[model samples]
Target: MTDLKFGGYQGDKSVHTRGGRVLAEALAKETDGALTLAFDESIVSRGHKAADLLSMTESGELDGCYFSSSYLAKRVPELGLFDQHFAVPDRRRAYVLLDGTLGYRLREEVAKATGYEVLGYWDNGLRHITSAVSIKSLADCDGLKLRTLANEDHQRVFRALGFDPQAIDVRDLPEAVKTGRVDAQENPLTNTLNFGIHETHRHILLTRHLLGVALVLFNAERLATLDPDQRAGLQRAVDHATQAQRRFAEGDDAICSTELTAQGVEITELDADTRAAFVAAAKPEVEITRQNFSAELRDLFDKELSAA
Candidate 1:
């Protein structure tokens, strides 16, 4: 029997960890116990940062992990295609593009450029802003210290939207929010609540500026050493987990919102005019960032986006 290790940064109850658990069970069943998986659901509990999962998996310290695509944009610029603000309008459209040709091409690129093989794309959720104070317009963002992923494109778009963007790792965010190190942060309601960000940040602004996706990654060299049947079993496990994870993510927004409101968190939905103003304010930065992507990648994204 082959025993594999999987790691994630979120708590055991989070969608990411739940998906990892699913993968482990499915892999064992598919392989008829020829393969087994042990999941370390929260590596942060062991004193590792969330961003460290990428290198850990690359170095084979972990057999696999699910990490946000934004973290790899610098290494695989094609992934920055997903980093574009307002490009993915909603969860349905985001999945259409990700489950289609665009996702296949990007997966190939990631394998070619890095030490990992992409197994599946999990919905990271549609992100929204949670602030210490109310934010209803673009002006409300001016000079506010906003915490964002460590992606240049994300930082650029937030900066253009009048925010003072700072990149903070997931492990440090709760303390940062509590200590007022950041005036605001953006995440899906699931993450905001699960990470305890909502406890400190009283206002939840429905910005929906970006739809996030996490890549299910396995060490490429280790994967190559697996027999054909083992590889097929692993793929099947990932597929099953991906579908289940998306379903959990889809329903979690409403559940999280209800729980937040019960806890007295102020939920603000942006009116049409306010949302449009944000889109308009972010347009120039989006265009400028797109110019930096390879023409082939941009063309692929454009074709896929239109079809979506």
Candidate 2:
């Protein structure tokens, strides 16, 4: 029997870790104990940055991990498609595209580019802005120091929306929020609450600016060493985990929102005009970024987006 290692940045209660647990059980069952999984629920607790997971997996320090697609965008430019603000209207539409042709092509591209096999797309939730002060209009964002992922496309979109965006790794985010290092930060409500950002930032702006996705990745070389049955069983395990993770992610938003409200955090839902203004303000940046994508990728994105 072989035991493979999987790592995650989030705490054990997070959907990412929960999914990892599910994958471990399913893989053992599918492989009939020929293959097993050992999950490290919070690698961040082991003094590693969340962004470090990518290189760790690629270098085979970790056999597998689930990480945000934004971090991989710089290396795999095709992934920048997911970094576009407001491009995916909601989680349902986003999943349709991800589970379809666009996702398959990107998986191939990612494997070719980075030598990591893409196993599944796990929901990272719809990102929203949480601030020390309420953000009601575009003007409210001007000069605001915002914490964002280390993705240039995301930085550009936030900059166009009038925010002064800074890249901060997920490991350092809670202290950054507590110490007022940034005036605002964006994440799903689950993260805001889980990471304790909601405790310090009293206001939650339902920007829903981006629907985040975490790609389940396995080291390709390690996968290639597996027997055919083991490889097929691994894929089946990933499929089971993906379905459960999506359901957990979908339910988390509502639960997190209610918990935030009970904690006296103010939740702001933007009116139509306000939301439209944000989309319009960020449009030029989105268009410019889209131009950098390959014609093939752009065509695929357009087709999948329309069909979704």
Candidate 3:
């Protein structure tokens, strides 16, 4: 039994922290306190940003972490497909894809690349664009300086939709918006409220863009040192915690929308035609993204997209 340090970028109130708590509780209950866990909030002791946590985990600096898939996509380009605007129809489809062979392939690739075990994926939910001005149509996104993840495909996809995308880290988003360095940004409803993105800018367009995924990963080498029963307990803990996190994210959309509106944030849900316009504008980029994906990833993407 070692002192295991687990952490993520979000504060204690976030689903990330809740998920950590859930895992910790599960481990304790299942393993009988065989492993001790110290959950670090906002990477306070790790001294690394969320995006870099996976690498830190691999290097054994941090035993494990929870972070956005989009940030991890920089290391695994195949993951960028999920970041493509409208790539996933809904959260259900996203889960189907992530729980199937596609998810297994991604886990394998990530493990190989970073030496970390892809334990589970929790929902980040659908992302939407929010700005200083209301965005009612695709044209509204044009020429706007939008903040996007450092992933190249994110920048490319936004560019295809006529946005001037700046690759900014999520931690730096508030400052970017406050300083007027970027006029708009996109994230899940829960993320907007959790990070106070709604406070700086009042306009929120319910684009339901990317249904993002946040991965839970652990150091494979470190995990190997665990006893057999401890390993089983850890797996069970991840599964239980991931399910809880997904439930929180799915339920947050409505609650967060209500809170944002109560805070005077102008929220707009795009109509059929408006959504179609965005899809049309971004279609070429989607196709290009598909082309860029490896054959294995493309096959899986085609399967998921073609499924009823």
Best by TM-score: 2
Judging by TM-score, tell me the better candidate of 1 and 3: 1
Residue-wise lDDT of candidate 1 within 184-238, one digit each (tens)?
9999999999999988899999888888999999999999889999999999999
**What TM-score, computed on C-alpha atoms, does each candidate reach?**
0.98, 0.98, 0.94
lDDT for each of the candidates?
0.91, 0.92, 0.82
- Summarize candidate 3's per-residue lDDT along 229-307 as a digit string, tens digits: 8888888888899888888777778899889989999998889999888888888887777776799788877788678
Candidate 3 residue pairs in backbone clash: none
Q: Please estimate how well model 1 matches the true structure, expressed as its whole-model Cα lDDT.
A: 0.91
Model 3 misplaced regions, further than 4 Å: 44-48
lDDT of 2 by residue, 116-152 (tens): 9999999999999999999989999999999999988
Per lDDT, what order, best first? 2, 1, 3
Highest lDDT scorer: 2
Give the per-residue Cα lDDT of candidate 1 at 267.
97
